[model samples]
Target: MAYAPQEVVDVVRMAACLSLNLGTPDAQRVTSMVSAGQEANLRGIPVVLDPVGYGATPFRKHLCSQVLRNVRITVIKGNVGEISQLADAGGQVRGVDSMPGQIIPLAAAAAYARALGAVVAITGATDVVTDGRRAFAVDNGHVYLSQITGTGCTASTAIACFLGAEHLSPTLSPASAPAPCPAPATAAPSDPCSSLSPDPDTGTDPSAEPVPDQIVLQPHAIPPATPDTPSTAGPNPSPLGATCVTAPIPSAAASSKPAGDHEPPPYLTAVVAALAYYGACAEEGAE
Candidate 1:
């Protein structure tokens, strides 16, 4: 059954994040994936893309590149062979499996992250996750993880889940947000020029003689009466909708302090934590 564009857009908007995998990729899947990914981008939803078997065939590589080009992917999870292909470096893949000597280097992974402007995760014996500037090496998981056909696909899902959680959490909590905006009274002193009013006691020429009842009221001089029915003259400055209080965004250096002094960023923490959890579970299953 085909999905309506509005329905797809609504689904993307309501979702916290999106995960796309090309394990069984085809023309229809590629079209749908691009559409969904673009909608997710428009809604500011983080997206995780897993290019399964990317180097297995020329068609796979082309389709993967097309999707990446069209959407602003937040994170990319792939095997060493797939990432190597993406970097346009020498890589060998035989039916979706990396060749024995085609391991991806940590430096190259970091470069890919910088080039794509997205988190790059290259999984192997030593998984490397990078955001261009910082590279994290996670030495986790069990050999049995490789034995499983969809572990990489599942990892992408886990990463997307963590991203979604981080997106939902407030970047600046009450304790870290800049002090509440000062009361309107103290925002700024009334402008001296605007506050200046006509003085009835003193004439324009201070030395001039004062004359009683000299001030003649003009037709526009009277204060208009408040209409019983509120005036709808034009646009209202403060509309009836929700009132938003905008605060200056706290700088990263200032907001870095956590419950503990050295906690990592929420998304980084999530990635590390998810990898650890997956490793623990895989080791347990292996045992």
Candidate 2:
């Protein structure tokens, strides 16, 4: 069904997620896809794109680029050939089918994910999902899946469903820990020398001659303790001993933020979950 640009925007605003497929796109559909994607992005709705038959023709490739450029895609699901081609990693693609033996490489997929800044799922015998930083492999589907058409497209739809549900769920609400309290200030111990205030009686004696700088020696002076003769002195013993005030070391948990809190739900997780669910369903149906 054909939709106007305004109509597409209206649909996207009400939708939880948007899915774009290049299965049968023309110049008009391409414009609609861009318009829908932009509207979805503005509404903060997740978008899943399937670049069907991407490398089959230059026109399809161009349309894919335009759609991707216009939208902040959340996830991309495609066959090995299509994904590899999108990543600029050459692969044999005959018509709409990925050439047999044309396996998607993990390195290429990771590079693509990083370049696109989106979770990428390349479907095959062993489905690979990655968000650049982490990759997951889902090996659960029956051989019958390959026999069926639209399995790749179905996977894209499944991803959109999962993204939509995630969007609606309140689990994703912001749950930030409270800011740490400022440590209490403690009084510093007074220096022993500070106790010897200037003699009050001699305070105004400007006529007093400036005394020569000299070290006063006590009559009962004790020799500096030699390092060889270890003194059984506790920390900072006597008024003359050097004093050190060290702050308490914080606990490990308080010092470092929890790894879970820092990382948002991984996009790769959603992709893997969707693929696994589909694969499980396919396996059950086959049996």
Candidate 3:
């Protein structure tokens, strides 16, 4: 969100996390977004990529691949199909809803978590969370909540806000309001190296013909004229890879960074928020 810093400060700043929810089947576009997000993360922010309607298109499947390969997310929150699609584990999807998967078993989910190196949060009749080695299920939340289009993305970000806070605690506790996360670590060398893979739906070569809905973000490009505005530039959001949008919790150290690139990571805050949300919901009890 570089077009106007203030705008980013207004929209993204208030935001606890950055959610990449692909509305289309553009496999390649998804790839670009994942890379862009990691760039934000390097800056200390946390990113949450929500893959909707996986198994809906060959392009969508490929997009999942590109996303999985690029970002180091704190949490991967989705229904069964979305999570299943992520690990190259096959499953059926109904529009954006999950039908089921061969990996529906708890062991399968744990295996997927190990392979992907992420915490898998599957929201089904019950919700399951695992970092490959550990798993927890959350039975809170209303079914009506799932009807909304961006609810999952929003939920993921809400969790980010908590993690990004100074104590990595949710602001919901008025008595325990926390300060922001530390500023980004821009002094670190440029991270041109990312795990985000190219279009497997298209071809192995970077210059290969792109399949329909297949696109990837380049390693060097400028992002966000502002958070409200969308970026059209392709690839390379920053030549140095120091501008990841996924932010960490804002700490006193954030103030030490130089001007123009000192944005604190919202990611850590979001996670704190997520934990807080669950706590609140648990207090209220299930409907």
Candidate 4:
């Protein structure tokens, strides 16, 4: 599905973060989301699962559970009551929103995360993100933001904006993910740039993954891909898509050059900053 038209996939990948006002997706539709999620993981896009009103009804809870179990969710955002329900707190919920006076509990948040095997983010006057044992409190938001509808979804979407929306590698895992982007993500420990984040002992958000040092280059190296036959490009970049790359050079030349002792070409200085610096120093800018 990700290999489909660029617009569709980009929207689909960012749908988790974007203010996608999708109605309660049915089981079959949610299953498609799961498929898209796994593809997003393989393609290295961030997936955010929102259990909008999980505990409010058996249907919501069951559907959210299925999505959590299957889809690759980078963060799960919900109000206190909603999150509590997912955690099985059985808090009283008036409609989908948490009832007024419902207190957010750290234990419930933690339990929900453990049960779903993913990071949990609960939104209230203050937002709490937890991977069961580890927790982070993110306070960078305007109170007015919540006054509007779809604001929570917007925040989730904001997280994805730093991805393909900005600039980055096509193969690396997402960085600065507010919490764990659980499941189906293809990012690995071998990724040199992978953030060692969500500190288990203390709550510290490894700041958002730094955009790959923009190195001017040609048609970027497509992500590692399996093809019916080896082709030059895999899935094309979607508008809102963010890329997770392996060891990336600051600039394109460094990436293309060999690290061994071989001397760089004279023209190599023309494009590569490292080689250019060396060449200028070696020859004092002589023609």
- Model 1 sits at a Cα RMSD from the real structure of 26.8
- Give TM-scores for every candidate, taking all chains together and pairing residue i with residue i: 0.64, 0.66, 0.52, 0.49
Point out the worst 10-residue segment of candidate 1 by lDDT: 214-223
lDDT of 1 by residue, 1-287 (tens): 12344466667777888888888878767887889999988888888889998889989988898899999888888877788888775677676666654454444554566567687777766565656444444554687776667888888887888688667656657576544322222332222211111222223321122211211111011111222423332231111101111123234465433232222222543554455446555655676
Q: How would you encode candidate 4's per-residue C-alpha lDDT over 1-287 as one tens digit per residue?
A: 23233344465545433222123557666666666666666665555556666576777667767766765555566677777666666565555566765654454555455555555656654455555434433332344544555555544444344323322332335574344332112334223212222222233223322212221111122222122323222253111012212122234353332233122211111112211122222223232
Model 1, residue 128: distance off in Å is 0.8
Give the better candidate number (1 or 3) by TM-score.
1
lDDT tens digits by residue: candidate 3, 1-287: 22232243344344455556666645445645665566556664556666777777777767776776777665667777777666555567787777632234444555565555555666654455554433333433455555556566556655555444432343347565433222122211122111112322223432122211211211111222233433332242211112222222233443233333323222222232253354335334433
Name the top lDDT candidate.
Answer: 2
TM-score of candidate 1 against the unseen true structure: 0.64
Show pairs that collide, candidate 1. Answer: none
Which has the better lDDT: candidate 1, or candidate 3? Answer: 1
Candidate 2 local lDDT, 1-287, one digit each (tens): 33566588878887888889888879988899999898888887888999999989889888888998888788988887888788877776777778766654454565567667788888877676666545545656678877777788888888898777657654344454222212111111122111111222233221122211111111111212233433333442221121111123233354433233222224555566577667767765787
lDDT, candidates in the order shown: 0.58, 0.62, 0.46, 0.43
What's the residue-level lDDT of 217 in candidate 4? Answer: 16
Cα RMSD to native, each candidate?
26.8, 27.4, 20.0, 20.7
- Best-matching candidate per TM-score: 2
Question: Against the correct fold, how does model 2 do in TM-score?
Answer: 0.66
